[model samples]
Target: MAEKGMWPVYGHNTAVHLLQRTLPSPLADNSSQRGFGGPRHAYLFVGAQGIGKSTLAQVYAQALLCTEPSDRPCGVCRSCRLIRSGNHPDFRLVAPVNREGAVDRSAGLLRVEQAATIIRDSILSPLEGRYKIFLLQDMQQANESFANKLLKTLEEPPAHVILLLTATERTQLLPTIVSRCQVREMQPIAPTVIEQALGQHWQAEPKQAQLLARLAGGRLGWAVTQLHNAKFDAERQEQLETLWRLAAANRIQRLAFSEQTAAKGSQPQLFNMLEMWTTWWRDVLLAQANCIDACSNIDLREEITRQAAHLSQESVQKYIQTLKRIEGYLHHTTNTRMALDVLLLQLPQIV
Candidate 1:
């Protein structure tokens, strides 16, 4: 829990607004009553990564723990104070631990031990707050054993306990767990929404904000990351140029260009770059097929048009399918060099 005047920052204003709307009404609320309708337990928030699922969970938890009991958390209340200090006895956070016994900060997976610990703690009454709120971030990372272990408690959670699970991919979770919880799907923030947020928080110039928003693909976290990344602009330009040159060239030159691009970075980085290139190329192919309205890589529209003029629409479509296959294979095999080499060799044939 964060302290007074401190809440986890998020880029999605609509999500914050949604939580504000979902909080129990002023007339029905009691200081001890938490969650919707006096603490009915367990909620699942599902969405894409970096789309504010975890942030929303925290906001809801804060609302549950607020002692003052307004429409939302009164930041100055005793319960809110406790939560902000991370000293709220009723608020338990179950997340994966690392080798050093610290919470694994990266892709924190909830393990059996952590789930057990949460279950053990749930048996007891809250030390201060009205109800116990468990904020489980990244539920998709929880293994079957851990998820199953959670089932019994989740099925019949304590009257004073609430379980809030956040996941980027809900399909990765067991259907049993999904069925027991009130699920809310968090949508990706629109590019315009992201642009407005960036402008408000960062005072970014309109043109720069629009560009960042376009590159972000409706993910504010990614937009923020791009804002901080010194080389993002240059790298995007270079990648676009490389794709254009390869697509426009003769078969031999295209193959040679692919090999050169493939050999430029470390295996993982090279693979990632190729993945981006492939996505951009696919968008170009789509634009060529008169699907320009559906293309995501709109920033490269002009370049796509330039390349599409020289290539047959069918050839571009074939290349797009080949790139999809290459992406699929990259996930399974470790021989990236060989995989990429073969992909590069075949790409020229598509042209």
Candidate 2:
């Protein structure tokens, strides 16, 4: 269950304030108004992954249906509880699914059939709640056909129907669809603010919170998730180990590793691993400059320092550039095997 009171959000306070203000005020005169308040029929939440865009959207949906007059979502009312428990009669969430019916991170795709269902469902009156909400997660994953189907609904939505769409970036969506909704761009939270929230609100230990805050890259949701997810740390450690190994690997060995990674068919995971390598090289550059404390991989200062001495600053910087180029191509139309092979060849061998 979500924490009681106002929405339980940590970072992106500005976006939170906008949502609180734009959402229907619960204190309106009941006799004069039929519902809580009039809210925009369509909203597009734009932000990076793990930035709490979906969390804010759900909280706003609760506000649209909560019966309390002063505090919306009272987090205690029948409507609030139903929504939280995923038993709300009028709430619908559409997301991409794999063959097993679970969310697929690497190859997520929202089909046109799902959009058609949403369009058909939007015309009906709410069965229980005051408003009906249709939230589409990862709208960027929707194909051209899906976008066209959804666009029709956004163009002329029912008064009681609220459409919420979340995406990593606005450019990933069609301009016509974007124009039909109110866009809310969420920014990353400051490290200090995240650290303070972890310690005071989440009750995290001081040292752990500080480390998470620094490593989260201004993403509070990511930091908070790390606290509860033991596997997150393990995976990160594995990535760091892979980075150290790759730096010392010869051409034949690196090519073999690349071949194995490309066979996994998990492009997103591979991209993330490469991104970590990029960050590691950047840290090495900082170590070479004697600014080891400023590195994102703060826990690996001694290792970075030792590796920095084996390679010149020019090699470290160039490898960082190469990793970024590879990342850019992988996101689009590029051969994964070919790209990874090139990337492996560029890794500097230790002296």
Candidate achieving the largest TM-score: 2
- After TM-score superposition, the amount by which residue 89's alpha carbon in candidate 1 deviates from its true location, in angstroms, is 3.7
Question: Candidate 1 lDDT, tens digit per residue, 1-351?
Answer: 122333444444445555555555545633434545454578898886566776678767888677666656766877777766767788876666655667863534577888788889989988876677888988877877789999988887877778889887778789999998878888777778788877888777787788777656566776776677789778877866666566556657755665665566355456546757776767777777888755656666776676666677777777778877886676456556566666665653224
* Candidate 1 residue 2 C-alpha distance from true site, Å: 21
- Tens-place lDDT per residue, model 2, 203-286, is 999988888887777777778888887787788899989877877888888999988998887887797688678778888898
Identify the runs in model 2 with alpha carbons over 4 angstroms from their true place. Answer: 1-6, 25-38, 200-203, 288-290, 312-314
Q: For model 2, what is the C-alpha lDDT against the true structure?
A: 0.81
What lDDT is reached at residue 142 by model 1?
A: 83
Candidate 1: residue pairs that collide: 2-84, 3-84
Model 1, position 28, has a per-residue lDDT of 61
Superposed by TM-score, candidate 2 places the C-alpha of residue 159 at a distance from the truth, in angstroms, of: 1.2
After superposing candidate 1 on the true structure, give the runs of residues whose Cα lies further than 4 Å from its correct spot.
1-39, 76-87, 96-108, 234-275, 289-300, 312-351
